[model samples]
Target chain A: MKIKPECATCIIRQIVDISIEVTDDEIEQFRLVKGCMPVINEEYHNNAVPAWMGTVIHRHFKKISNCEDPYKRLKETANDTAQNYIEDVENKIKNSDNELDRLKKCVLATIAGNSIDFGPFSISEDIVPMIEHTLNSELKIDCSKELLEDLKSAKKVLYICDNAGEIVFDILLIKMIKKYVNDINDIVVAVKGKPILNDATMEDAENLKINEFAKVITTGSDIIGIILEECSEEFLKEFEQADLIIAKGMGNFESLTEYNLNHKKLYYILKAKCDPVAEFIGVDLKDSVLLSNKQLQKNLANIDKN
Target chain B: MKIKPECATCIIRQIVDISIEVTDDEIEQFRLVKGCMPVINEEYHNNAVPAWMGTVIHRHFKKISNCEDPYKRLKETANDTAQNYIEDVENKIKNSDNELDRLKKCVLATIAGNSIDFGPFSISEDIVPMIEHTLNSELKIDCSKELLEDLKSAKKVLYICDNAGEIVFDILLIKMIKKYVNDINDIVVAVKGKPILNDATMEDAENLKINEFAKVITTGSDIIGIILEECSEEFLKEFEQADLIIAKGMGNFESLTEYNLNHKKLYYILKAKCDPVAEFIGVDLKDSVLLSNKQLQKNLANIDKN
Candidate 1:
């Protein structure tokens, strides 16, 4: 599951090469961007693909020494890089800062809106189905009565969220939780604050309207983990006190696994979106479905009745 | 320079797309690899490109989702995606344990065995001169006799290095210095340890043979920086005591600039590989090559005479 260094460079080269196809001029622009480098050698790809793709063209052009007709190669690379970049941008916009949100908006508008209208781009037009599937697969939960009971008795809940493109789903889930729960004050939604390339920063969480629903907090770390390396002591204290933590997406799963909270309640809700994570959880990576804390969901109903 | 989230994503996309183009089996292999995923966007371009091309074929795949060849479109997207995957691999390689030492062996083997291949990529033969020119221009230095005299008075020197691709050049430069200075014991080369995605880790430094001629130390951080974020305080204290500190690459430059060194000795050596760093140092981005402390080089001369 670990990445080889050669493969890492190869991926970067491919990203860079593709960007050149779109426009080599952007290569320099991309090289200057921080956090554009991808995460490597882990069980899951997580943030690796998108972070490297966004500004990869320039490096490719430079690598090829700026060929006279780099379009074919550039175009080829762009498709690969753009797919990952879009995922990452969406994640950042949903979970981190305004700048990223704005940039994501601009980029989406360009690719899905303007660029598609004028040039050759193969992006899907209707994203709703994907959204639905992502939610169904990535955000499904066990809605049994026992689960509801556990929810009622839970002292605190932590919601760890994912991609900007998918934030609407998260918001909807939060609203649903509010309707079911009596004390909304006990819920905490954690989001990104500062931008570190494509990773969700604290600023991203604010824009997604996640802050409006609960106690929103930002941990300064670029990677999603529960270690408190980037999160302040206060945040860590809050995390420790929470009765339940619902982590969404692959990044959080990758970094937080080390914590393995035995004393506290926890739930991992996500689509087997990436391979390494799925492998870790012993699930099919391509299941195209959702999984929840089946036992917890059952328990919640019992607790709620009491 | 900090990367804008959208731009970063875009670059990643570009790389992912290109990777798919390299091979068809790689696609299935990629899926098998950790973190790989198929494009699940609802707007799958089925009609844009031809199917025979598998993932790499293009004409069938238009840039538009509505294009005629869905297969080609998918292939192009795969190509872009491949790039992203490659980066993931490279990051792992760079962050591998004892990367510097490993790299040293690789480079040495390549140079000695005349197997200087960057994988299957032969590159445009012209890229070599361009890269050479870039390194030469960016790393240029003009040391004065007076500056050499000043440095010769110092007791030690510390070299903080950058990427694996460029470490060979650094080694060459180090050898040049040893020829002139008799106090080889004073030289210390610091590299990164463990893996941190895109940054040059301590493993990379060791692989590159930085430990052979100088005292090698690994900063635990994934990226290169001067403040020693991951290194122990004892290491920091030693770094502070060095008569000269030669920092290589843009990462170190960015992290080191904010420090208040007072009258302490420092030497920043790097190629203005990107624009912002060039602007920061008042150089042109297109001008390739690396630079070093002009005065510090001259200062070493007086030590030889003494």
Candidate 2:
């Protein structure tokens, strides 16, 4: 979860890209990339988390450009794009033979939606094809059966959403979980408190009516994933209390894995897009993963005892 | 070639790669990338040339790693790899029906050899398949016949060498120029004075017996391409005096094109491997370019007149 040496280049590449997007003035673009180099120089280290560094650099970029949300339009477009695929995903999940099949299909659809990423790595911007690809592709790290078993005892399920367009598909999964996992007393969806890339915000979740399926909350800060310290006390209580947490996207995997949160149920659902994440997850780049952070959680359990 | 914003990432990526390669020590890798950030921060700009910044940062890397010629093993491997392909290339040229076919084959084979690159961009290190690929590919901008016509009246030629392995193929092109273009009085093969990447040094040129084909000299500077100011007075004099300049590889294309050199006959013969260089040549990426700097040369002529 710590930033790789390669992350230095990728993060800078993103800075350059966003800087260009934030302005037409070449001098301004130059100034933005120029100014952010010090931030990267200061923060890019072995122990720093990539997404944590991303937040630092992106905040610096926004301060310089006077852009409140660089990816605002993209998030809107992504929401619209994913809107078209919802019915298709619903139909595919409905076609499942049994509850497990239906649930797995929903998970796959959500993982497919994770492809609508604007991270340092390139993925297919075209949505439905990726939907089709993900549905057909087997998860590289499947723990859906374990997820199903955990649902049996779970009182609260917290779903952390990633990108906006993809959040539409996530809505499908939430609906499926609610309909079938009837024992679950609560379903909570957490979105970003502020805009970062295409990551869904409260406004986006509200526009999508994510509250129709579950209680919606923000991470309470605009850092990537759940940096526990940055989260609101209310959100942290929910994070601590949740029996099963469904975390979407690479950013969460990157940010959350840094802590030894023992006995916490964290499910990382994403497509392995970059070398660092893929290598850490022991999967090929671009492979779909529905991974239980059970291993980390259990390992930390023993570490805590020792 | 003014540095693209993307170049910031790429150059840093190169730094990270070299830092890792230079030392197995993780802390050292961190330190090396860490130490070089200031240099990148200080020099990376819209106006800076990528290769020139490469020189600056690489010098900084060399200083930190306390390593000389980080790519020395790869260079040796490249030379050995290319040595195996020379006979095959020579045979292909020999099978040509006429002078134009033979000469063009030589150029194509030479361009194919340029694929043995270890820059930030990924290229197939496999030599012969690229040789086959290049031979099959047409010059996106063909001026081989023009090169032949120019050769008829040329007094001296300066053949700038690129990577170590590719210099093996350059030897063949130099031989063809010598044999067919008999009116040429001199042929000078210029290589790097010190090692940078796999760029041919005098040691590599000498090892490959390039002296058998033409007189060999160093650029008098280890910097990428022809930084005319940094280059030795002797090499700069040769650069100015040579009637036809056949520059090999992207580095030469990057560094040499910054000058006005209004009347100079500079043929940039290489594969257009990156976006900036490809755009400048008006060719697609990975296209073979036997590009005459005629447009650049003539455009500057108008400016000079003004």
Candidate 3:
């Protein structure tokens, strides 16, 4: 999606959030924000995607603020908070009588986990309420029925995780998927190689004991979302080989939406955070979306035929 | 006061406001905001004053948007809304039994008018409720008694106006001042040389029929506030010669506060809208302040001595 006029303010707001997170020294915060203005002015373009712009702005922010990971403390807090909800989520799935019903509940839990972002606007310390809200609310775009069909036949599943605390919920979803799919060995969970915002890394996977369920690997870049050219060859090979891709969060949705994946089936599960992204996906702000790329392509093809 | 980290976001937000105001075309709005990123990045400094930064950003917004006066329609609306309150304000002064009480009421009315701003944050269409709110609220920094004392002895008063609709209230205050201090000829109302933001200019003065009371002159610059270096020699002469000065709004407060005015008695009457300005002046956000240069200088000198 193209960058909106609102993105400029959103980017600055993110810098402000980071600056405040890094230091209590108001002078230092001011200097950090001032440093970001030039980078935004030089790099911001109407046609540019937010993830691409975010990558550039965040790079400048880290260098100028002298804080390699401004969201480190916040990420830790999010993970700790999210860890508390793991038992409840696991119980929600286990209590379900039917396998398909359990899988659907797991999908909702995974989408709920995507809410724990440490970006500029999101300052919520507790994800329990947010998770509850997501669980209770109906999805704006539910492609879960089709997704379930895809999951039944999928040989390899690539589950791309979003945030730190949210990873625990992803694990719950993975466990459910293992029941229906070939095995845990066939599923590969992709995390960020390095720290960027609150995105989960290999350390988070290790901390959450994700290795017990499915093999965890890194995307080999600190970019907020998956940028194909920046990814490691090993991750790219896994991405190419996967029959079904479950991309989590708005960051991945923004980065991977425009790409021609050569008929690979991808399902985007996220809460539309900003207006631009919401508008791009034809959903309202704060709507939980479960969209299938194959279905979207078919709809577009039908429109072209008309 | 020095620009805070919060100001970076606020400045970009102002750009967004202008971009939306100038054109309905979302693409053009996006382009306009993208253009401002560099100017903000390159020019924003922690040590810089907000008014100085605002001046730069507004100038950039106008240039990029190709709209010379972005707030023209909003200014007209503000003036029209404020004009409706003139009768009520006049009644407020008339109903007061004593001259001093009437003058105090006029001061409140003028401060209330200052609320009619077309800046990034303010989008309220009605000033009646705002006027009522201001009238009922107490000033955070009540230097009104000192201001009245200074007006008693002053020969020439330089009244610097802020926004459009707010000018009507200034006229009311000027009328009250004229009744006590001197004739309208002795009082000169200073406005912006050209259109910038919703700042009152000679055109606004003419639109509101300000000539009925006092002589309105241009400050010889389109900057958000009174930048003395950018002003014409005529305005500087008037600024230097005035016995007492009444500066309205936060814009003037920001730009004029740091200057060494050689012990000139200047009264600032403004609502503390933003956090940094409010914090600098030792008032809570949204609190109305009536502060004098003499009191401010005394406090600073005491701090220096300590």
Candidate 4:
């Protein structure tokens, strides 16, 4: 489904909002949007930084009486601003010899990655155990007959990742998917297009060497759920052909749920990371994991058998 | 006030942290030397983005420890990542016609600005009103006189600004100074050299056309108080000759107070923008104007007159 322009803008803000240490309430504002991070990238293509600056500039600019596309104008300005900053950093890097100094700048350059608003600390802490229980037990697998049968028919699999600190786990999931899928090419791992939040981007995938094993793609949308609307033609084609899509983190769940995938199998694997999502799924966000019924049952039985 | 290396690094991280929104207090839990931001910036020459990514690469590369400068290695990798992302955005901008589309990209670019953490919205909100009060009041005129007097004898006036949203006000302050001082060459408005907590950054200043009036500067330091140690020689030279320094926000107050300035006639004119700083000065952060005793008395008397 195509995302509304306002919704898309809001989602873009939301994804970036998530990576920061902003209050849980502030972060919660973004949680309302599904699949947040991908939208931010999508919005970028639409709105430039200087254009974004134009919005702030709008307040300063006296002549423009009616700003029909304030978001657009602001974005263009933000783009100009960004380019200048990138140049500034480049100059700094050219002259500096201090390792610690260089490292801080690299980290600062990776700023968007850091803005992942985790929401209230309490909400974040509260839901971890439940999500852990689900991912560790109900979401785990022993290659059950029913699940394997389903997997045999699966033509392709898309694994969407979230958060840099948690990226190591995503690699583990990719490793697990290789066990179920025969065609390596059929397995697509979608990291962030850019470092919108502390999630693995295409660069991160290359750094982590995930690109070595699988074709890495960014959803081109910032929302957590699968945004069919913003997906590039290439991404969309893969998504359309995919038999199974495994979305990691709350962002994927939110964006994916907005659309009607009909019979396509979609699995959301995330520790209810925030309250709005936890409440939506009828589980505590702190510790709950929402999974495909098939994955949940198979993993639960495997736990029972073990 | 020379910023310590540890403090510089921390401040740089804080600036980046706020911009990227790295909230997990743990992410900020770095070993301090003096100035976290400046130390890191010095080591890398103000290129912290690559440095930040290097830290992550260091985390992984250290497993084998073959690379001589893991940080440098990481810096190279981050450069590749940043370049790719930059190219991607440039490509999109090249392809798109929608002004709104470009605006989104601009916002994406300013993700660094977005990452800057203001701690909590509540904290920022609580203190902003006082600053607004001072800005709105006639009492501001009295302090401006002292500030202007201090600036007149000085070769340069370093006007430190904070908060991106609040920067508009800083512009007004700079305008006031320009109107009174008549020496546009002497005015230097230093924003965050890097993005931190939505503070007025060099990029923001540029976008806002801050340099159109004054020489806008950013310190490599991220200390919360008056950060002099992390600044460049160009800035330091101005600092040395300055008859007066006007600090605009709470972070400056926090970072600057620790180091003793040899009777440099520093005037910190901010509405008690935070509780800790307000408490530090033994005033109500919510309602007080932070000025020297003489300026404070004059401001209060002016308040009574009004």
Docking class of 2: medium
TM-score: which candidate is best? Answer: 2
lDDT of 3 by residue, B4-87 (tens): 877887888888877887888888887888787777776677778888888988898888777888999988988888888878
True C-alpha contacts between chains kept, each model in order:
0.06, 0.70, 0.83, 0.00
Query: What does TM-score give for chain A of every model?
Result: 0.55, 0.92, 0.94, 0.52
Runs in model 4 deviating more than 4 A are A1-306, B1-117, B120-145, B148-155, B220-226, B293-306
Interface RMSD, one decimal, each candidate: 11.0, 1.2, 1.7, 17.2
Candidate 1 lDDT tens digits, B1-306: 332212222223332443343334443334333232222111112221111111221221222222332223332332233233333334433553553433332222212111111111122222344442332231234222333444456577776765444454456545534444456667777665533212345545655566777777766444335445556765686687787676665556656655555465665655454444455455565332223344433444554566
Query: Which scores better on TM-score, 2 or 4?
Result: 2
Worst 10 residues of 1 chain A by lDDT: A113-122
Model 3 segments more than 4 A misplaced: A23-38, A64-66, A81-112, A120-136, A152-155, A168-172, A295-306, B24-31, B34-38, B80-115, B118-136, B151-154, B298-306
Model 4, residue B19: what's the lDDT? 22
TM values, all candidates: 0.34, 0.93, 0.86, 0.33
Q: What TM value does model 3 have?
A: 0.86
The digit string of per-residue lDDT tens for model 4 on B32-115 reads: 211132333233322222223223222232233332222222223323333334444345445546534433333223221111
Instruction: For candidate 3, state the interface root-mean-square deviation in angstroms to 1 decimal.
Output: 1.7
Tens-digit lDDT track of model 3 for A1-306? 567877887888888888888999988887888777777776677778888888888988888877777788888988887778878878877888786677678888887887788663546345567778987687888888888898889899999999888887888888766665677767999999888878899988999888888878999998878899999998999898899999999888888876986488899888887778887777888788888987667655776687
lDDT (Cα, tens digit) per residue for candidate 4, span A130-174 = 322332233221223333455557768877666553454355446
Backbone clashes under 3 angstroms, per model: 159, 1, 4, 148
Our model 4 lands, by Cα RMSD against the true structure, at 23.9
Per-residue accuracy of model 2 over A1-306 as CA lDDT, tens digit each: 887877887788788777777778877778889999999999988899988989888888888888889888777877887787778778888889987888788888898888787775432245556667887888877888998888777788889888888888898788866754453448888999988766889998889887777888999988877789889987898788788898999889898888876478778899988888887777788899888898645544675687
